[model samples]
Target: MDSTLPSPNPALLVPPSMPLYDSIRGSIFAPSPTVLITTILVIFLTPIFLHFIVFHSRSPISLPTFLLVGPAASGKTSLMTSFESEPGQPPVETRTSQTPHSLECFVPASIARTSEYRSAHDPSLKAHKRFLLLDTPGHGKLRHIALTRISSTTIRGVIFVLDSSLTDVRVVAEYLYDVLLTLQSSATSTTTQSKKLLVACNKSDAFTALPPSKIQKLLEDEITKMRVSRSKGILDVEDDGEGNDEKEWLGEGGEGPFTFQSMEEVGVEIEFKGGSVENGEWRNCLSPWIGSCL
Candidate 1:
């Protein structure tokens, strides 16, 4: 009837004593050979385990390298600069003005995403490959050298930038024709593989000064004409039906069809500050063309 229960049994609450704490303390103060070996093993294996988790866990895809070529002041440098960057990635930029041209190394974010996609979708696509953006100087004299470099390098694609403020369409046409000729003549072994050509009509800030519709029409016309020319060359070689002649003709002055656009009409925004143009931004504009080629 008492409201309070009888006092709890104190003896039952006490734990049975073993020298567990003392043993642990002794081991810490004066470690045994097995303890030392175990500690060393943990120290050595921790990093290896972590590395496998971090790196080998994700399957990556082989990203293709791209070449950036255009006339001087055609915004190639700016385009390269505007390419998406990943944290902790090294910046890529051109170093020398002449001689042995070298591309600055940087990891493109697009390639990273593509690699992630491959890992998710296809296991066979897993491989460690990089998208190297090779920036070549656009001087007329170095055109041959640039072409040679592009040909020798395992280029996956080419981005050709063009200025759209030309007064005469014929001049732009000639320049484009020359670029096509160079690409066709270059010593690339893959004949059937189609290389991507992205024509960025840069300096769209001059859109207000020039008629946008006219610029677009001119660029479209030039692209159509170039494609027609390439098709005609392909047909001519087929008609001849001689392999050597076909190869010769293709190597002489034939190129794949190029996707062209005026950067102004394409809505490429060029940022400027302190009397200097900053980076340019094209929102997924080149993705379709790149996808087709890749």
Candidate 2:
């Protein structure tokens, strides 16, 4: 017997042709109308489809959190209760608290999630984006509670609740100065996203209550004064060799008066919103994230 078998026939090796083969072969060489349409659709739709996927994947894996901090009797507790209350139920009674209390709250359906896409029904929206809301004692002695939490990585934002009718604006501004300054320090070392701060002017219904915009102005003026005083103190310490190691200004340094907008330079976004927590006006005025972060 011969050692090698006869060579295989090239004719037998060719693939069998099917009914659709000629048409597909023809389209590959010169695209038909259907092929051209499909190519055009893919070219146009691919970017949009990829964008949707990218945005959808960015939904936060862990629950976002917000901390409530302000002067004592600023109604932080009341605001928390008002937010956590079930729809149609009477408002929850609130009292002064000495310790930080945290509760889970869901975003209102009316508030859309940033992660949502147009075609996608928004699972994040439907789930209402559960978040943690921590109410910390606002007492001067107890302020460390809120300020300490500000450094935690889990805290996504801060709400500085204040009595709009406050007789002395310095008290509110001082506490806020501490909060923002702490946030400014934190923003320095952390590479994480910037934190948001909302000045919630509570008790909007009070006759003496200042509008949130006015309150914002008062705070800016007071903080500017505080910054100047602090700079002088830092200079004194530096001269004495006690030493200043880092920048302490809350925002940009300029001869001009300070504004809340200045905090943006330090990665803290500030907003002023006034509402009567007593009457549920917060639902209409507070940030949508406030509802999302119970």
Best by lDDT: 2
Q: What C-alpha RMSD separates each model from the true structure?
A: 14.2, 13.5
Q: Which runs in model 1 stand beyond 4 Å of their true positions? A: 1-63, 84-129, 185-191, 208-279, 287-294
- The CA lDDT of each predicted structure is 0.53, 0.79
What is the C-alpha lDDT profile of model 1 across 1-294, one tens digit per residue?
A: 779978989886766554687788999999999999999999999999999999998887544566767676665665565454332343345343444333334342334434545545565454433355667777777767557655554666676665657555655565555555455554244444444456666666664324445555675577557656766767776779843333333222335433332222222212111111132333234443444344
TM-score of each: 0.46, 0.73
lDDT for each residue of candidate 2 in 1-294, tens digit (9 for 90 to 100):
779989999988877775489878878899979989999999999999999999988975767788989988888888887767754465688788998888877665546445434345655445555677799998899998888889988888898999999788888888888888899889877887777888888998999998878888787888889888887777798999888845566676633678888778888888888888768777556647564333
Number of the top TM-score candidate: 2
Prediction 1 global C-alpha lDDT: 0.53
Model 1: lowest-lDDT 10 consecutive positions: 268-277
